[model samples]
Target chain A: MDRVPILKAGDVLLVSIQTDLEDRTVMALREDLAERIVRTGARGVVIDITAVEIVDSFIGQMLAGIAAMSQLLDARTVVVGMRPAVAITLVELGLSLGGVQTALDLETGLRLLGAGPLDGGPSEAQDRR
Target chain B: MTTQPGEQTHIVELLRSRRETALDRWTELAGAELRGRLSRGELRGELDDLLSLMLRALDGPDAEAAHDELTAALSEMSRRRARQAFTPTETAFGVFALKQVVYELVTESGSNRPRLTEELMAFSHTVDELGLLTFETYAATREQVISDQAEQLLELSTPVVKLWEGIVAVPLVGTLDSARTQVVMETLLQTLVDTGSLYAVIDITGVAAVDTEVAQHLMKTIKAARLMGAECVISGIRPQIAQTMVALGIEFGDIVSKASLADALEYLLARSGVRIVREEAG
Candidate 1:
């Protein structure tokens, strides 16, 4: 199983998944993300799936689970770069990721996290935290 | 009744003797029925070719092969007529008219009346088979045309246009069905990804009516777009559609719906932090 790499930028943790996520990989990602959120004391987490082309119910649940877990750790989770097809499939599958924040791309994800573009000042994400 | 070889030759000879007369009479009959939809000369040409083919089929040594060739020719003519929007009656009459011409020629000859009547019956049977074949082909061709038109309409109806740098709009202009809604959803979602548009406005000004099913489809589409991190605004709700939706107890929830496309665009622009100001002309 390939391990998903999690990169830390300032107070945000960025996880750019570049491969097909298997069940074990998702579980590992969830555990690893929870651990890193506490260790780095990050206020935001951005999961970039621009390269992910396929997803199943397991992965959908994992995303919502990650968002919920991060919130408990005093962190906001934003899933970004979701392909239109994937988003549609998730919606059809009755998993809208209701509690998870979404962005169009990594830049927007970072901005949503209030970790990019200081010119816009602190975003609502920062104010809430 | 099967046509005897001797009777077949006799009828073939009679037709060969007066081919021109038979063709002229057949063309006149068919032309009158068509009522100038096809030129007289063009109808004569078609009948001339068919008469020669029929003669060859009766006179040819390989009866089976010649008959198949004649059927193919009839099918080809039927397909052409079908495409020209000729009614099934008009097309079958073109073949059936030949039977009348051959009967006239047989009676005018007046040599072997009894035997000739038997041969005429066989020839009439062949013409009936040919006429029925033409009818079947015409119906099949008409069905093919209808299905092709339906496919074309499906492709032509849905169009996603970029309304602004970060906005796209789908102008729906017909009755909404499941198939069309699926197409609209896919196209709008794909456009959103391609343009990275943060806003989508579904303009339904041209849509004739809205029912619960259409409302459900719209809600599903809006939810899908929102899942992709884009906001969707439903616009151009005519008063009747609004009343119908309310009467049906359809709730749009917190989704921003505006009366006109202009309102939707204005709302999206404001949400995107773009301020529109009036500039005085100097």
Candidate 2:
């Protein structure tokens, strides 16, 4: 059971999954991510799954669960770098992970969390506000 | 057992002796039907090869082996003709013509009337079997061709074009069946990942109709795209399609859908912070 490493970058917690996750690993990740979110007082959490090629219903639920848990802790969760096939499988499995925010990559994920440049400066943020 | 060895030899000897006349007549009959689609020399060469194979099948001690070789030759010719777009009738005629030529030669010789008729019957049966073989091969080849074209059409119709740096569009232009929708979904999603495009526009203006199934497929595609951190906009909904969707109670549920692709692009560009300004000419 390899532990998934969670790296903290500024106010965002980045979790890049580099191996196939089992049931135990997913459970552990959920617990560990929840703990890290509160301890670091992170504003955002980014889960990079670009290297993950396979996923099942359990993993799908785990992602949604993680997002929901982070939101309660006052942190926005953005699942990033999802491979196209994995995303399609999750959709076909009826687990669209609707509650979770997604980005194309880590940088975009961070941007969605407002940790990256707003691109258009304060005017863009004010416009949205 | 239907064809006696003696009868077989007699028929084989008759064909061997008048091979020239039989070959010439066979080529003429088949070539006339083809209308120069195939060159005369090529037709003659193919007929010559088939005639020799038939003679060997009748005259040889290893009858089974020779028959296999003959059918193999017939199948090869049928397959080639099929690929060349020759009609089934034209292909079968290439084999049946030989039967006509052989019958003419047997009647012209005019020897052992009843016995010759029996031998000719056996020869005719063999030729009929070969003729039917050609039809079988021709149909198989035609089916192969049709399926290949269908697969190519599936691939050709589902092209994911990059509309902008951060945007891609899949212009679906056919009936959206499960198989085709699966293709479109996979292609669109893969393009989103490959190009890292955050915006996808599924322009269904060319789609023939919109039903519950098609609407479901479209929603599933948009949802999948969203799962990958990209937003999908359904564009090109004609007035009739819009009516059909509304009548069927198909709700897009917050997915941004615009009337035209230009509108979708405008909305996406604005969302992405791209400002398009038209300066007045001085």
In terms of DockQ, which candidate is strongest? 2
Give, for candidate 1 chain A, the lowest lDDT window spanning 10 residues: A120-129
Recovered share of real interface contacts in candidate 1: 0.50
lDDT of each: 0.86, 0.87
Model 1, global lDDT: 0.86
Q: Which whole-number lDDT from 0 to 100 does residue B112 have in model 1?
A: 73
Q: What TM-score, to 2 decimal places, does chain A of model 1 have?
A: 0.91
Candidate 2 yields a Cα-based lDDT of 0.87
TM-score of chain B of each: 0.92, 0.90
| Model 1: DockQ score | 0.41
lDDT of 1 by residue, A1-129 (tens): 788999988888989999978989999999999999999999999999989999999899999999999999999999988887888788789898989998887777777777774553565434311
Q: Using lDDT as the measure, which candidate wins?
A: 2
The alpha-carbon lDDT assigned to residue A112 of candidate 2 equals 77
User: Which residue window of length 10 is worst by lDDT in model 1 chain B?
Assistant: B1-10
